[model samples]
Target: MGERLYLYGIFPAPGPQHLALTGLDNQPIDSHTIEEFTFLFSAAKQERYLASRRNLLGHERVLEAAMQAGFQTLLPLQFGLTTEAWEPVQQELLVPNRDRLKQLFAKLQGRREVSIKVMWEPDQELETLMRENEALRLERDRLQGKQLRMEEVIGIGQAIEQAMEARKLDIIQALRTALNPLAAEVIENEPMTSAMIYNAAYLISWDEEIAFGEQVEALDAQFEERLRIRYNSFTAPYNFSYLAQP
Candidate 1:
């Protein structure tokens, strides 16, 4: 087909015209100034990009570099976003949403996204739940190795799953309570696996990053034996920006 551009991020205009970074296909990253905002993108030889591990990391590399290249603030675009030309991107997406984009950029300035992932052994959580929730424990005991009808087994399984979800929610709330005071915004994304009890991204100001780390350390110390608590303090604020989809 004709030319295509892989969009990465947007920040204020008058940024370095050259990104000093390479993105997909080892292409040089560059900028296209649109109004008061500058859009960062790279030329794509492929018609479109698939979300393979290599391709995804390549996309993120440029976005991360965009922030590191003196502009700490950025509105990270979605992965695999492309346009044949900037005309459509401007006429439809950027120009229409200019004000909101600027406001988001200003709000995101001086802040970075911090990620926290807490995972626990599912078997352990289940055992704890069964012990703490007597009704669930009784249900599990009643259903254990029983020669029951399909519907009866399914019902018992559903009940156990519901109880497990409720327990996960309580733990997520405690995690939020422990970390919310240090964050400008906290977003709880759905846990991807049964072992995941918490997956959240926090917008933390640069000045408070050390305090945030201390808070996370205390939380980890509290649950060191039971849970796997991990945090990364430096990333573009995607969750709290225009890049986030409704």
Candidate 2:
């Protein structure tokens, strides 16, 4: 099969720049300039580039290097994007969407994406919910002295599950309210696991990063006993980068 360019992302063209970065198959990372933008990509065979963990991590490594090199407005391409040649990338993607891309780049200048994930200990939250819920308390009391029927046990479990769901919603809303003001854009992602209450991405400007971090620390301190909060702030703006499917 013919070689294709595996795309990582696009950034402002850094004049005479060369990154000591490697991509898929340990290929040296490079770029192709088009007007004011430079596209980062590496050569790979189609089959090898499709969702392989090594290749995917290689893609991220290249983008991370670009970020370190101080390309402020980087737009990450979706994983597995490939084109037969640079001519088609310019003709199909760049030419057709130059103005829109320029606008997006300008808007994203001096900004970066941050991800937040919140998880709670299910047993702890369930115990707290049971204590606060009269129905759950009564149900537990009812079952205390007598043998519980299968349906009764299931009912109590279901009630706890429902309470957990509601609590998750409330916490997610509170998180959005607390963090939205510091972000240029907020993207709520699907929870990755049963214990995950919040999974979101924030596009935050450089000037506001300190404040944003402070707010997160405050929130963590506030909920330290009930929740586990984790964040990553130095990634490329993947959530806001919406290019047409190629």
Candidate 3:
């Protein structure tokens, strides 16, 4: 078996068809005499096959299908990793990295990634801030009764800018407190922007989806009255079932 060529991923046992579809049609995974193991190989070398999109898709399909069948797969090699033969994969990479791989798989098993975002149109928020600023109201009232200088008009513009800044900070803080707990980790992608401010988050856990949905639903009920703040949650865009944790 040392001389035989293969690319291996440590997936939960009880599969052979998975191995077959993933590129192991000629070789049987069950035949390996190694303890608690399964492996797959087709005609091409393991490294060469992983380099193409079609092959990478095939690999992910195998792993995801296996996971759906109650098998937890620890994909050691990413889509583009290469190996000369099975021995090097087993003896060199897999052996030296055994503990790390096990820990990674342990963390990834039975878990999925969910992403959440809070976004609002900047114009909506800006309009809301303008309406809520008492200073603007007072300035308008004073200007209504008297002839205003250019400096007074400039001061009003500065006041609006200050009010907008304060409003942005307050809203961001409120959203952070409200949504951060519902996620395992929150990654702010766009931060606060002039067009649309957004907070992106990654939630990890099989159980978190429902809890997160519930939180979004509850927040919707509370913020719906305002009609300015909007929030949503969704699965991340990666095809991999488990997102590599940092």
Candidate 4:
């Protein structure tokens, strides 16, 4: 019988071996040779094949195994990738997709993905700040006094609205400046609370991950009194489009 190759996502050499421990058909692929690194893939006819949930889990398992093995992988065609035999996998996928795959691998080489979410929790201090703002407090006093006409009351309401808007802007600007050094790409999401501004960003790195985390933590600590933010990091799946094409 001919050898069947189970294709896992592509990666650089030194891939994980225990990946075979997580079976493809609930059976492991054959061992790898000393000279070449091997990944696993299931061989089924492409013409009638479907990417069932079972296949998706299998693929995820394969990638997770690679991560555990200390190797990063990019599954270019995430799901529904198939071949009838090892030769087809080598010829159709490994050969034709070789350049693209290599490019993606190069782009992601030594880089990790980090996510940051900035939120504000309403605290007593912020309320105190609002109360201390002379303009807003004065407006509240004027409205309560019942000494103003309708036009004057409208004016007071407008003044209070403007003051609140300024406060929000001031807080957002502070966070933007504080976060400038830590993020590669920053996206502002809807505010989490009346007091909190949301800034979500993805940071790319290989060596700077530790420094990046420390920086974010420092920011959190520094702003903990008025603003609170947190961050998380994860391994990115391989993608080809992230690279600029030649």
lDDT of each: 0.83, 0.82, 0.54, 0.57
**Local lDDT at 70 for model 4:** 72
lDDT of 4: 0.57
Candidate 3 lDDT, 1-246, residue by residue in tens? 333344435553433443434443233332122234454333434434435676665655654544555554444345544444566556865566556655655655655555444555656766676577676776766777677889987887788777767776675676677667765545667756554445565545666767766766676576674434444433322333233444
Using all chains and alpha carbons, the TM-scores for the candidates as numbered come to 0.84, 0.86, 0.53, 0.55
C-alpha positional error of residue 214 in candidate 4 after TM-score superposition, expressed in Å? 1.5
TM-score order of candidates, best first? Answer: 2, 1, 4, 3
Top-scoring candidate (TM-score): 2
Which regions of candidate 2 are displaced past 4 Å? 1-3, 14-16, 45-47, 143-159, 244-246
Q: Using alpha carbons, what is the TM-score of model 4?
A: 0.55
Candidates 1 and 3 compared by TM-score, better number: 1
Clashing pairs in 4: 6-40, 6-41, 7-40, 7-41, 8-40, 120-196
> What's the residue-level lDDT of 62 in candidate 1?
80
Where's the lowest-lDDT run of ten residues in candidate 4?
29-38
Which sections of candidate 3 miss by over 4 Å?
Answer: 1-67, 72-96, 136-166, 182-196, 225-246
lDDT of 2 by residue, 33-58 (tens): 88887888777655445677876777
